[model samples]
Structure formats: structure tokens, C-alpha cells
Target: MDYEAGTYQKLPIKQYPARELGETAEGRYWRRFLSPATAKQAGAVNYLEFCPVRPYNLAVTSSTRVLVYDGATRSLHRTINRFKDKAYSASWRADGKLLVAGGQDGIVQLFDVGSRSLLRQFKAHKRPVHVARFDPGRMHVLSGGDDATVRWWDVSEGKQVSRWEGHSDYVRAAAVNPAAHGTWATGGYDHVCKVWDARSAQSVLSVDHGAPIEAVAFFPSGSVLVTAGGTQVRVWDLFGGGRELACLSNHQKTVTCVTVSPNAGPDSSAAPRLLTGALDGHLKASVREGVYELERFQVTHIQKYPGPILSLGLSGDAGLLAVGLADGTLTVRKHAKPRADPAKAGILVGRRSRRAPALTAATYRYFIRGQSSKAAAKDSVIAAERKAALATHDKFLRKFRYRDALDAALSTRRAEVVASVVEELAARGGLSSALSSRDAAGLGPLLDHMRRNINDPRHAPQLAALAHRLLDVYGGSEALTGMLPALTLLLERVELELRAQDGLTRVQGMLGPLLAASVGAC
Candidate 1:
């Protein structure tokens, strides 16, 4: 159907089923999985981090252990145990060979991924360490703790090189500047986000977010910073006098974690995308162009979990997204880009091919004869078969053979024929008998057709009647289990529409008396 040039095509709602609906291409970019619970004990997942380099293993911290799983397969590769207390903030070094984690025992532990051995342990803080990360150079580690101090440690010596004591509350968020040497950022319960340069003993910049900061991260270019707190994710431009660039407030609860893709940038061809997780079990991904504007930061996708989101991690290539939940469910989703449909493109090519030919008359005639004969013959055969099938279908309908008519219409998969057969059966009061006698195997296609057209205004009453009869016969059978979700969703929508219609009728009745009273008063 033709529409205004800038308008989008209005797709029929019935064309998309509950299982096949998504903001992006359905079934292309997203999938859900519940990680094997046997590998890790029952506890809230604390953090999830993917390796920065090759193999892209995922580290999941829960209870007292850190579990590593293959990124592609989600199979448990190894379990790093021996934590004296609950573990939190599992991070990977740049090389992907080492891992660092902070725990409730007031210690920072490092593990060698290749050997699965404890490489070093630093008794770095007086209280539990809440967040940790490796510096850009990988020579030192940065950690924040409940002791209200940001400490730096030399990995080789396993000793604290320096510490920054400024925040008066627990430091729960930290990140290393990817583009700047000797620079890092941190946020804490003190409601402040601070940026520090290692060359100096004090913070170089500070911003008051007006709420307790829960997570902080730097843009890939290191020219801007993102901080999450109470339901808001804010971006600041470091090079532009630390100007507040954008405030993204999409979550309904406290924002728990945030991460950015490594390839995201302001000047690159791809728009920079940000991923944020909140305590309300909502994960949102937003994108912005090079020109930073408050209204330009648009939400692209949102995924819901069963429990509060505790941690979020984006793969280095931005192809995989890992999410951890408070209910101990870990989900990994792969990002997919929609590909152009070759069938539609071929149709467009055929349309354009109808213009005048560029070849000589003799050449065109020769090629046309070679192609047209086979194509014409194939088209003629298909047309003849369709005509015969329609004749047979019409003969059954004329004789009031609804059962055979329905079978023929279903085989053709034509909406008009199917709807006519169903309507006719319902009008004749034979819907229940016709549907109930069919075997379970044959009932699937018929039920699917009913589900799709049940809410359509012209045929809703008849389709709904047919649906109830089918459910009555097959609701308890195992064969219907695979179709249960779709059927349930359709029925729920029908119920909602019926309630809405009832409410509208009541409103119209009340308005009639009010209108009459107003006329009398006038």
C-alpha cells in the first residue's frame, strides 16, 4: 500500500505473534538463556565481566566463588574458589590471561587464567573492596573499597604503590581512562564522581551528581564520562570544560551498572551506544550521534529480567551482552544486524528490468525467446493448478461440506478462504463438532489460523467461538504444549478487548442520561 514518502508501513498486528515480536528484527538480535545453576551456588550474581582480548570468556561472581564460562557456548570452563568471603567486582586484565577480584575479606586477589592458579594477593584495604580494574597499561591495578579510599597497586610486586583518600563513603564504582595515560575515574555513595590523574596526589576534576553514584565509565575516546545514580545516566564532556552533555533517565529505580562499547566514538561512522542496568530489572541501550544533544540520545533496545540487575558487561567487539541478575540468573545475548531481503531486492530488480532494452533488436529477440518459453510454461502450469484447486474448494463450500472445505482452505494457507470456512461453520452451529473430531496432529494448523484471526473485527466472533471449541478438545493434550504460549497470549488480548468494549458500553449508557438531563436544563 502506498503512503506518504516519509511514513512507515503500517504492518497488520496479526502478522506478528507474541513469540515473534521485538523492537529490532524479531529472532535476529536477541535470545534468552538461564545459565546452569549447578555450577554455582545459590546466591545473587554480583558482577559479570568478559575478557578484553581473545577467547572472550565471561567471569561471573556469585556467593564466594568466581565462575568462568566460554562466551560462545556458555559452558562452564573453570571455577575460581578459595575466597574467604563473598566475592565481588571480577575484572579481566587487558591480556585476558589474568583476572582480579575484590572480596569481603578486605583483600585483592589475582588469578592466572591459563593455569587457574592464584598468582598474587594484596591485603590492600582495611574494609571490603567494592570495585577494581586494571590500568590501561596493565602494569598496575586500581581498586576502591568501603574504607573510602582509592588504592593503586603494582601487579609485579603485589604492593600498594599509592592511594587517594577523598571520598567519605564507600567507593562502589571505578574505571580506567582508555585514551588517557595515568588517568582514572570513580564514583561513590558520597554522591560525587571524581576524576584523578596519577601524576598528581589529588583529583583533577569533580562533579556533584546530587545522588549516590552507583556506576561510572568513560567513553571510548576518554573525552567524556558517564555516571549512573538514581534512575538517571548522565554524560559529561571532559574536554568541553566538563560540561554536562546529556542526562538519560529511562529506569524507574536506581541505576546499578553501566558500560560502553569499545568501538563507540563521536567522530566514527557508527553512533556510540551505552548500556545501562537498573535495580528495576530493566536493561536499556541508547545511542547518540557525534553532536551531543540531550534530545538526540535515543533508546534503541530494552530487555527485562526476572530480578534486579546487578551487573552488565559488553564484549570488546560489542557483539555480545552479558547480564547478571539478583536471582542468580545469568543471560548472554548476541547482537544481530538485519540483512536486506533478497526476495524483495529481486522484485525491485524485476520492476526496473521492464524498461526499454539497451541491446540490439536481433540480440534482444534471441535472448527473449530463450528465456520466455520455459518461464511462460512454468507460469501456465502454476496458474492451471491454482484454478483447479479453487474449483474444488468452491464445490465443497457450495455443498455445505464445511469439514472438507476447511481442510482444503487450510492446505492453501489463504486467509480469505480460511476465514470464510470458519465463519460459515460458526453460522451453521457445527464449529465444535468439526474441530473436536480432528486428530491432534491436524488441529495445529487450524488452531494457528484461528489464533491469528481471532481478534480481527470482521470475523472475531466466529473465530473466538472456533477457538474455544478447539481448546475444549485439546487443552489437556501434550500435542498442544508447543502452541500454549501463543494461544495464551492471543486469549489474553481477546479478554482485554472484551473488557474494553464492556467499559465503553457502560460509558455510552451513562452519557445518554447526562445528555438528556442537559437538554432539559437548557
Candidate 2:
């Protein structure tokens, strides 16, 4: 009977400090929304909105026009270019039948989505109208403009319903409260945000946001308010008399837009998610309920853009995400379908094949019956099933060739492999034989490795012992005495390393007492 050779044993891998990984749930969730579709516009994309009704047609407002995209195909469905000057905001009604937008020409226009005809146009603002949104009842529209005023217009009457002129500067941001009728908020360049009731002309609530506010939003319950301004997104407790709940200052530049994800809930059982876009080219999703123990808000999702993000929008179902950038790029991401389990899919295919008619040569699957019948194993499974190939040094070690093993390890130019081989040779009492009869050229590689790795703490002791052994074997030989300069440099490196370690030790000792005192004080 013949015996197979034993497998070569691998060296013990050196251990290092383990690095901690952060939460991956958000990363995995956001990664599922793949297959991005992008469109180029004529100018900076300033606004993006998805229709609330099904098949969620997207509305993109750029320079002089608002382009409505077919939700199913993501193709341009309608182009409304009736503006005399640049258009600013394009808003969709709750029923998705009417579209309203404000323009730099100080005109607010409403259009019937089905007919693509202008139904009404209000021209009351003296300056550019920056924001226009429909009220919850769909009977009135609210608009804010650079004229430092917020106005409400009635669709049936085709005239202004009310005007509130409290803002000291340009009124750029406005949002209607979803849970409350006749309630809405407006933000302005005066760094103030005010909530108003349509029943009265006077403002009902007010808060100073400290910076020119760009965007504002109301929580689903209409109890919490969010404001985005210079690099900060603030959450306010409306029920608590407009007290600041959390000040999220994560962005490095001005936050241009903020919106609440439709999936967010009002109760604590489901944490609300806030999406903010900034001029720093980052879109961040933050959770109002704390994710970490001590953090007030946790930014869970982060996506980068090619240019400054000007506007962002999500569908009512949170299935589609749209981002508008300053560089005339509009990117839309649709949620991907979940993949079916492999075993279930295989079972379904097998059932179909068993009940089907005979395969024909004209069919594409007829020629490929054997090609994909057997599923390929995963990489981890394949690695577990296959044996590892031995290296040159490992092969020599199996044959009890210690000197050849050491030579092979040195030839590979890896300090860890060379150290492992030298340690093995020393254990087998073949270190002397491996170091014997080597000239200057043959020994250059070994000396160079020692010079490079003599100070590495992992292999320091082994290399030092080998260095002592080499000195003992070649100290008195005339052939090796000519290499004094190389040995001197090695000695200098060891001394320099020793000095560095001593300085670190002394500094640690000095810091120990200070750290202890600080801890005790805390």
C-alpha cells in the first residue's frame, strides 16, 4: 500500500487589533434602489416633484420650462413652456389633475394636466415668485416671492384670497401643513419662520432660525416643523411653543432643500426620517429618534452628487427618489424588485418544464439545456471545497529541506515568510547549516531584510536571535568582515527605534496622572 504525502502546515497568522464596523442596515437598504436614470436639462434644475396620484409622473422645473415625465417609462410626457421669464417652482395638486408654478416674471400659473392648457394665471407679486404650493383642499394656492410677501390665490375666483406681508426680506420657502386645514409655514431671507392660520391675517406662531431659511417642512402630524438654512437643519416642537428639538448641523454648505419621507410615521414606534439636500453636494437622511445612545439625530443614509443639490423630491409612496443639481443634471432612482429565492425559482422552473411540450431546435433554451442546469457554487463554498496550493517554502518544509526552505523564503522577499522559515529551521537545529558558506552576494538579501524589519515588534525577537547566530558564525571570517557598513546601519536603526520607544514610554507616564485626574473630576 502507498501512503499519500501529508498536507503542508501553514504558519500561524500574526494577530492585529481588530477594526470595528459601523451600522450597515441603512447602507443595505439604500443600495437596493439601483439602476439610476439621468436627464440633462438646459439650465440648473431648481425643483423636482412627483405627482401624488398613481403612476407618479415627475415634474422637473428648469430654466423657462417645467417638464413632466411619464412615471412608468421615465420619458418626457409634457413640456409646459408658457413662462415669459425663468420658472422657479412647479407644484402638483393633491388630486394630480392640476399643476401650479411660479416664475421670475412675477406670474403664478395653473394648468390642467389632462388638457395641457393654462387654466388660470395670477400676476400680483412685484418681484420674482420663488415658491408656489397648493393648499390641502385644492381650492387655493399659496405663493411666496422676493417681494417679501406670502399670498394665497383662489382657483375658482382667479384672484388673490389673502396676503401676509410680515417678512423683512425675500420670502423664498413655504410649505403647507398636511394634518391641518388652513395652516401653513413660510421661511424668508430675514432668518424667520412663521406659521399662519387662513382664518386671520395675523401670524399665529413665529421662530427665529438665525439664518436665511431656504426650505421648510411639516411633520405628518403637523406638530413638528423642520427648517433648513445655512448648513443647518433644525427641528422645532410646535406644541412646545416652537422650542428647538434638535439642531442638525452636518452639511458643510447651505442646505437648499428639505423634505419628509412619506414612509415616516408620527408616533415613536416608527421613527420619522428627514431628507435634506445641501450645496455641499450631499444628500443626507437623518432619523429624528436617536439611533446611537447619546446622539440626538443619526444621519443614516448619505449620497453624493456631481454638483450642488438644489432640490429633492420623493413620491407619496416613497418608491421613487429625484434629485436636481445645479449643473443641469436630474437623477431619478427607482426601487428595484426584490430577487426571488433561488430554490423557489428552481422549483417553479422545474414544474414548468415538466408540464410543457417537447423542446424545439428553434427555441433558444433547446441548445443550452446542459449549460445552466447545474447552478454554480458561491465563492465561499468553492474555497471551502478546494485545497490550498503550497508555496515554494512550504513545499521544501514538507520534504525536511530546511536550508532550501530558508533560501526559498528569502528569495520571495516577504519578511513574515522568511521569519517563519528561520524560526522553523532554528526549532529543527538547522539554523547553523542554513547560515554556513554564504558569500557577500548570496547573503545580501538576508541582510537587507534584517535592515528593513529588525524593529518590527511582531518579528523583532526572531530576527534579533537570527542576527546573533549570523554574527557568531561570520564574526571571525575575512570573507564577511568587508560588509561592516551594512551591519553598522542596522545597528543605527535599532538604536533610533529604541530612542523612539523610550520617548513614547515617558510621554505615556506623564499623561497617565492627568487622565486619571480628569476621569475623577467627571
Candidate 3:
């Protein structure tokens, strides 16, 4: 259970179900949708969540700080700060007015959307808080941390309610079923996700992933639960008291996170919609029903990010998304129109700068007028907002519109977000080497994504050798060439993380191309 500290030896990973894709009616439906999306230049994304209150909008991710984008306007509204030490995992509260994030410091912080102020910060856990969620009614926030603790906090009072302890190691995940109250789930290093009564601290169920359970979610009806692990998705009919209903497989890497489709609602289709993010940087969606549809299991698309994804949060409107990466890039994303003319695209490539944080005005007032009157209560609150904004640093991170900023970055190949990611990787002892030595055994989704990309001569070449390595180790590719540009940039952005190291470097060996390639590795 003490895996991070080496109390437990590394286990050989096995990505299972061993299914490629077989077409059916569902497969055709997916391909139809995918084709349109791809035609619109909408690539696969890493993380997605619908806003808790609003159904139409969402929060989507790229590789850098969160974005707040409007689905209708397709324009970014704001950005959340890139937490300096680590990526910030988020969940909107039931009201959709507040967003909570568990960041590197093992602290759970609250952001007030109306005022754009970091409302609170609490030492929520001993180790990093990997996952966090707010109670359905907005009275509480639940967080699972590396300390192997599941915590419930009184959101209104800003006080800790109780801490539940059962797992012997880091608690990797936690979730609240929207259709139920006081019922939640937590998973972690112990290789199981425990469903518990949030109020009573009573364990209701524990399901095995045969390895660590990375992520979990509930269907809109709360009748089924979806879990991600070992490249497959296991669906349990909670309606039948946690009976295993179906095991879905198609990915080629360790499944890192899962979420129900934004369309999950009472009147929605009986077929559940599922989305996934993984180590290979591919984001996929599937429609699961009575029987698993193989073609639907096929990855819808790929959103390229360098390194394993750390966390995901969808906006309330279902129009925006927030994705956090181990490399320190937290990206927010959404749908947008592409340039009609490539030559003129350069004019508005980078995001048009936004108005400075309103707090700057407050700071100016505080310096000039507030200093004249310490008795003014408004000055105190304004000063706090200024401090929080300053601590937040990047405009992209300060605004809640993180997804919009990411879209802007993607539009222009903006360098700031990638630069931040590289710095984090460097500090973490060079992520490339860690990835190389990971022993890709059991990474089916990753291999699947990669192998598919390799077959494309435009971006990726040398399919045979890469495919062989992939099958022999990870067994398939979960990524593709579409995301290569972003992945490459993500790696470069964070390469500075290794800058301070003493000649420790990354080593990647690949030939120019395969014999089948007519073009040079162009």
C-alpha cells in the first residue's frame, strides 16, 4: 500500500480485455460524430466536466492552466492561476458559483467566481490531495489525499467536519453521486475504491481494479458507476447493489481518469456516455449500454499533453474544461472555429490580452485611498483580493477562464504554458527518463494510441519498430499523430525542469523513418 515510498514492490501491469475494435451500429454513430468533429478541427481532449449547475457549458482541458470559455461564443472568459508547485485539480460546487481545487501543497482552496477571489485555503491533507469534490447541496467539500484520508469539510463555516481513515496508503480518488446525498466513493494506492457514507464514515462497497483505481464516476441516475484502470472501464450496476454489469476495453494505456458524459440527465438516453484521460495523453468517449459496443469503445479523438495527466474538472455549462498535468501545465479548452486563411491566422494567433485583474484597481485604491483609512472594512477585503490575485501570478491562471487560455495557446502555439510545464519536469528529475524506464508493460491504451499515430507518415513515421516496442511492452498505442505537436511542445515546455540538474539528461532514440516512407521525416 505504501507504493510511493517503496513499501510495496512494483507489480507487473496488465492492460486487459485485449480487445481492438469491432464495428456495430454504435460504432457507426461514433464515427459519424468523430468525423464531423475532426473536420471542424476539434481534437480529442484530456479532461472534461459539465458545470454543476448549468448543463450546456463545460470545462475542457489542454495541457496548461484552466480556461473559462463560453460554449456559445467560443471565446475565453478567464484563466485560473498555474499553481507554482503543482497542478490544481478542481470541481465546481453544486451552486456553480464556487470552484474548489486541491493543489500540490496538500491544501484545498476555494475560489469565488463572482468576486474572483481565492476565498479560503485549508490544510486538507498530509500528502497531496489527488482528488476533491463538493457535496451535491454545496454544504461540504470532500477530498481524498496521499495521507490516505478522506476528509469532509463544512464549506459554509470554513471548518473541518471529519476525516475518514481506512486505506493504508494514498487515497487517489473521490466522487459524489449527483443523484444521491451523503454517498461518495474514494480510491487510491490500495488498489480499490471504497464507497462510503459521507456522514457516518461507513464503508458500503469496495471494488478492485487489480491495480490502483485512478478514477471513478456515477451515471446520472446513480444506477451505475464507471471506473478507469488498466486500460479498461468497468461498469457496475449500482442499481443492483454493485453488480458488475460490463467491462469495457479499447484503450491501450493505463486509464487515468473517467467521467460521465455531460449529457447525463434523467431524460438522457439509457446508454451511458463515458469519457477518459490516460497516461498516453488521449481523451476518449464511449456510449455504454446493456452490452458493450466495441466500435463505440474506439477512441473518439486525442488531445495531446506531455506526461501523464494529473486531474480534470468540467465547467458547469459543459462548454469548458480544466486539465492538470504532472508537468505543471493546467489547460482549459472548448470548441472554436478555425482560421479560414492560414496566412492571416498569424494576426490573432496569441490570445488578445485581457483586462488586468480587477484587483489591480483595488490595489491601486488601497495604496492611495485605503491607506488614508484603515477603518474602512471594504479595504480589508479588497486588499485580500489583491494579494490572492498577486499570488496567482499569470493572468491565465487568475481568471476562472483557464480553458479559454489553453485554446488561445493552442491556436498560436503560445510558449508561456509550455515553458511552465518544462520547468516542472526539470524539477521532478527529468520526466523523460522516468517515462522511459516505466516498463510499458500493461499500457495497452498508450500503445494503441501510439501505434495508430506511427502509421501516419505525416507526423509519425517508423510504425513497425515503434509498433513492435509498443506491443512487446505496453502492447498498443493510446495516442496518435494529431496530438504530436502539443505533446512535443509540452515536453519542451517542461524540459527546463531538468535545467538545474547536474548533467542528468533525457535520451530518446529513433530512426528518421521507416522504409515505407517516401518523404524524409518531414
Give the winner by lDDT.
Answer: 2
Model 1 lDDT on a 0 to 1 scale: 0.76
lDDT of 2 by residue, 185-214 (tens): 999999999999987856989998989999
After superposing candidate 3 on the true structure, give the runs of residues whose Cα lies further than 4 Å from its correct spot. Answer: 1-48, 54-66, 82-84, 262-270, 291-522
- Ranking by TM-score, best first? 2, 1, 3
Q: Write the per-residue lDDT of candidate 1 for residues 345-424, one digit (tens) a residue.
A: 65555545556556666675756655555564446455433222234445565555667767877887766667666666
**Residues forming the 10-long window of minimal summed lDDT in candidate 1:** 8-17
Give the backbone clash total of model 3.
Answer: 64
Better of 1 and 3 by TM-score: 1
- Give Cα distance to truth, residue 347, candidate 3, Å: 38
**Of candidates 2 and 1, the better by TM-score:** 2
Residue 315 miss distance in model 2 (angstroms): 2.4
- List per-prediction Cα lDDT, in the order shown: 0.76, 0.84, 0.56
TM-score (all chains, Cα) for each model: 0.60, 0.64, 0.50
Give the Cα error of residue 126 in candidate 1, in Å: 0.7
In order of listing, the candidates' clash counts read: 0, 0, 64
